[model samples]
Target: MTTYQETVAAEATIAEQAWAETFGRAMAAVAGCFARRETRATMAELVAGLLMEVDTRNCWTLGQALGHPGPHRLQHLLSRARFDHERAREEIARLVAGELAGQEVVLVADETGDAKSSTDCVGAGPQYSGALGGVGLCQVAVHLAAVTATMKVIVDRALYLPADWAADEERREVAGVPEEVVFATKPQQALSMVTGVLASGLDARWFAGDEVYCGRELRRGIRALGLGYTVGIAATYQVTDGAGHRWEARKLINKVRPEQWLRRRTGHGAKGTREYDWAWLEVRPDDTPGGNGNGNGNGNAAGAGAGAGTSVLVARRHRYTGEVSYFRCWAPGDVPLGTLVEVICRRWRIEETFQLAKGFTGLDQGQVTCWNSWMRWSLFSLIAAAVLALTAAAVHDGSERQPRLVPLTCPELIRLLRAIVLSPPARDRDHVLHWTAWRRHHQAVATACHQQRHRRHDQP
Candidate 1:
């Protein structure tokens, strides 16, 4: 059999092919904290585990790459993955910001709820899962993110609403919920995440999200910070037009502003005439979109960052393809209404990240139940997937016309990494010495990764 190494070299090799070098540096930065002794696993091995395992358990198998086996050292390196997330996010932001140095950037908020059996897990509760209706125990994390057409987005995130049981001293012991953790509203978490990104030195403006974070309180909070925002609002959320104006879509008589009052067909019974009121309004410093400090969007017209005496606001709307419902949009009067629309649309892309994280990076496949093991698996899995995504963006996504600010995606990146790691005649190469290059190259030369796709989930 022809060896992998020889086959790779025989094919047309690109110069610098520096992606491997870049990956190593990024892994080092991201995995710095997870370092144990020299005996512990390396970043490369952990990533391979993430990619191979359908779930988090692959983190345990990471030791296989280094010739280490069972009792997989899952705890030792997951800690390091935390640093990796921060670094990766920062790098992504920096790379993107550099690409659009003088252009506008959009921030979007969203959450994905995962249903689980345990109430002891952080934020676990009897919450509704859109994916699985009928109120199952679930957890949701709201991600506050920045996006641009040109670059990949990195969510500057904060995990949402910890389990109520986790905070209860009496239930703590039974459910394994940690004490330091506390219950938080998803919107509050979203704010913490956005501010966290700003603290990291990202000069971003313009934010958008679904109705979840577009509540009056959250919108008010964003405006108070002097940032521009656009978010979905409930149609029942009555807002007086311009200044102290107030009126609900149901009550307002006079105009077919359904264009202004954009509507989308929503809900289970939503059939026949389905549409939503997609409207935009301008809020003054003394005013808010949804009165009582409870609005979620910036209004119809998106505004910019506020200055002395001049307050800012946001605006925009979306009704989705299905579901008959009317969602209101809010933004300050001064912001560009057109740009707000662009920002709100950016949230759709983040879903792709989640999909890749699961199908490609093993976000949902971890089998570890140990406390230390859980944290390790969670952190490393995210990092590995992110690295793969960014790398692929750097190489394969060569569309010079589109915005190149965002990095490549996970699947594309992993293909390249594995190709190098398991390099060979990826394509178009003469057949010779199947074992020649592969055999000559010591197994130890290329880092051995965790046993992922190679394993069968037969263990009871």
Candidate 2:
């Protein structure tokens, strides 16, 4: 009979192998995006560096961690390297879709910002960044994520350019912004990304977003693609109730009877089940003029034909704070309130994706200023994140359940990956001496600059 310790060791080895194999296959799927063998190899190394633990995931540190003499090669990979990052993005979407096959999928849209100190960076300006918690100088990128019960992965992204940035030719040239690129709103960006992902043949049942994406264009666009939506709307959004009366979402929801509100669990959380009181009221679809359900002015009416679809205004109240939120919902048939609430809850998954991508895969750690470099770095970081997510999902599916043990998570999986699957950084005497000399040389140059500045100030 095998001893308990031996069995445990064997299982651990198997788990490590699973992680290695999963990562290898994911990288291989996107290999075609790079034409030359050398570029492909460098791309692989850059991704590996992103996966490794580094204080800052710029070319300098990543190059050093990967045992390189200088940051030139990695910098080139982001800046001037001739590789099809757009194709790579498509490949990433397909890879994620394949991994999540046979699962209920919801396409989620959101944007994230990286704070910047200077306006020299492309798309960096005073903007409202939820990540920054207010208006700040930053670069915002809109992203669309595919989510399921147990997995979430970002499938597409686009950099948001402010109006002035788009019109400034000199600054655009300096930042390498393509001439064809122009200013598009966040909802437009989300619509474009979602359209591209769906056009790539990735099937999703619903599209979800926050209040920012609750515009008529995006809603009608999503419905045109034959997908339902449960998008948040501002409390003041106008809606026509079933009685043909127009009222603000908040005012309309207040009319709901106390007994009509049903308490339902959205999903399981760290604490326990997230339960909320939900209520629904039938509403006139906004596709028609005056929302009268009569004439179509935009040629995109919700439920254009009889028995085609249904639209409703849904509200959710917190069980504790009693604070209420509203959503404008549409579905093909008369779906239950629970289904719409589930989609509403899944909107939070994109936020979770932002956190994981930034934390584990260095999604927001790029130091580049040019447009192409920024895009390449973001795409590579996302690829690294996808690898971790796929590995965690695979490990959880295959591993035996133990009492009192939670399922494998992306962070824990990354720890195991660095510990076993990834090659350890070189720690030999020669390697250590080289890094030591390099750091000291850098410090010497910095000290010289500081001393020169102080001398100039003293003389003045």
Candidate 3:
């Protein structure tokens, strides 16, 4: 008998308590990261501000949100505070595992670029911004997220310093870059994060990523660690057919018979099921153990397929268009195709996490210019994002009674947090209603404009 909005409101009220509990527990986990009690208290306020909507996510604005008399304390907490950010990340890994425990937790690795116009920001240099889809001046960081069917949270991150910046002694000293911090490629950064995750005993079943991490050594290393992986590889990657003949991935996929490709729902999209034509071919087994994923050996050996390792080439074809993509995977010989597809699709969850964190919690909106500050701000941002995600998961689990109602999203949860934090008096209901109507109108116009842009593209 209750209306959808009323139910949502009730759920939001319930989720607030969950958020507070989550935040408190998370703060406790990260308490040891700060050397001083004052620093920990200030970090709690900053994280609370980040969880709520704010005009800006800098120290000045955050201090105002926490009703601080001045911004000096908050500024010191980030820029000059003595805390072990790396240890905080380790704590986060454990906390995340506790929050979203599952049998088959997935670790997704990716890098995101944060645009920085000022060169003074630590690790800020002209680098390829993946967000921009082209080369642009930005600061890039390699991040790893723990993802499950219900939620996703970034548990590890490392800033990427260009070789030039690493080599610049003056710049390094001025920006507070550590003496031990050297230039590492994105893949290497990912490997370090993966190693950290494994060391933390996070129970990750699979490691997934794009071509940036599909190098031969990386794949070998992941296998050596006894972790399964499905990573993107180039179309030109070489493999062997059943007859032991070498072929490029694209050519091999093209040779896949029509009957071999099956239309399967890879995963769920925003609207509904995402179905695609998928086909897979097992690589010729290597006579030697731990061979690179490429299949260069003859397939006629009697016990070759029963060896210790298995490699495979999996291809996905667009349902609408025949456009195909390739991935090279190394796993146990008997792993199912559906399991491979699910792991491959989990790589996109990190992108979704990035969007949610950046849009609502200012994941890339900090103004710090020191190494310590950058690390601390990122740690707090991840905590805020995890709180939001865990709370949303709780709300979603409780909203099953109303079939017509939709589950809560990250943005909606963030808005609810803002409303709870900034609850106005009942006398101001008319004013709040007026602004709410205006916001809905603005959203409608924006949605129509977005749709029109797509329509124009379709027309052309």
Candidate number with greatest TM-score: 2
Residue 16 lDDT in candidate 2? 86
Query: Model 3 reaches what TM-score against the true structure?
Result: 0.86
TM-score per candidate, in order?
0.66, 0.90, 0.86
What's the true lDDT of residue 260 in model 1?
A: 57
| Clash totals for all candidate models | 69, 0, 0
What would the per-residue lDDT of candidate 1 be over residues 149-172, giving only the tens digit for each residue? 644454454445555554577655
CA displacement after TM-score superposition, residue 77 of candidate 1 (Å): 3.2
Q: Order of candidates by TM-score, top first?
A: 2, 3, 1
lDDT of 1 at 317: 31
lDDT of 1: 0.50
Evaluation by TM-score, superior candidate among 2 and 3: 2
lDDT by residue for model 3 (1-460), tens: 5577788878977888888777788899989888899889878877777865566677755655565545688778777878888898888788877766655888888999888887778888887888978887788898999888777888889999989888989989998888888988888888788888888878887899998998767766676677878889889977766677888899888777999998888777878999999998866533233544345545322121545545678999998988899998767556777888888888888999999878767789888888888888888898888878878887777665367765788887777877885332222455445545655786799999999999999994
lDDT by residue for model 2 (1-460), tens:
2454454455467668776787688778888888788988998888877878777788877877889877789888898988888899988888787787788899999999999998899999999999999999999999999999898888899999999988888989999998888999999999889888877778898999999999888887887778889999999999876555779999998889999999998888889889999998877677532343432233323332325476888999999999999999888777888888888898998998899889878888888899989999999998888887877777777767554556667886777678877776556788768877887898899999999999999994
For model 3, what is the error of residue 117's alpha carbon versus the real structure, in angstroms, after optimal superposition? Answer: 1.8
Q: Which candidate number would show the highest lDDT if scored against the true structure?
A: 2
Q: Candidates 1 and 2: which is better by TM-score?
A: 2
